[model samples]
Target: MRAGRLRGTLGSADRPASALGFRRVLAVFGALVLLVGAIAAFALTDQVWLGVLLGAAFVAACVNVYWVSRRLQHERPNR
Candidate 1:
């Protein structure tokens, strides 16, 4: 064992590609969930306005998540 060194194995490393892939997967899953939720809400409650509001919220959330992930991916690395 030594300072700044792992005792048994390499700890971790940056993997922007993996992070991007994960985001893509998440985005797809979230879109599917949004679709299902909207359909269920409509069928169960007959509330068109509620469905519209939820859809708008989902889009906003997706946009924010995408922007933040892109910003993080392009961020300057510490020297």
Candidate 2:
């Protein structure tokens, strides 16, 4: 209803504004670009099935990266 207020009935905010830092966001964007490139390469060569496989692999890699990042972040000393 107001300019900066939401209509949802929520309790409170308990999380940071952003979940990922700039570098992590950039890394994700870079990974997405590489995945698109791989898919495009396979599509151009008429290997759609391989492109699907590559897409799956890309997802796995992204998940792994996220896991590692979280672990490392947890181990990092706070500023």
Residues 1-79, model 1: lDDT tens digits: 5576533322235222336546656776786788778778888998899899778867876885687567545642331
Among these predictions, the greatest TM-score belongs to 2
Q: Compared with the true structure, what per-residue lDDT tens digits does model 2 show for residues 1-79?
A: 5577543433236322344455567667767876996778686878777777778877876886697578547644352
Q: Cα lDDT of model 2 overall?
A: 0.65
CA RMSD, predictions in order: 6.7, 11.2
Estimate candidate 1's RMSD in Å. 6.7
TM-scores for all candidates?
0.49, 0.50
Estimate every model's Cα lDDT from 0 to 1. 0.65, 0.65
Worst lDDT run of 10 residues, candidate 2, spans 8-17
Candidate 1 wrong stretches, greater than 4 Å? 1-18, 58-79
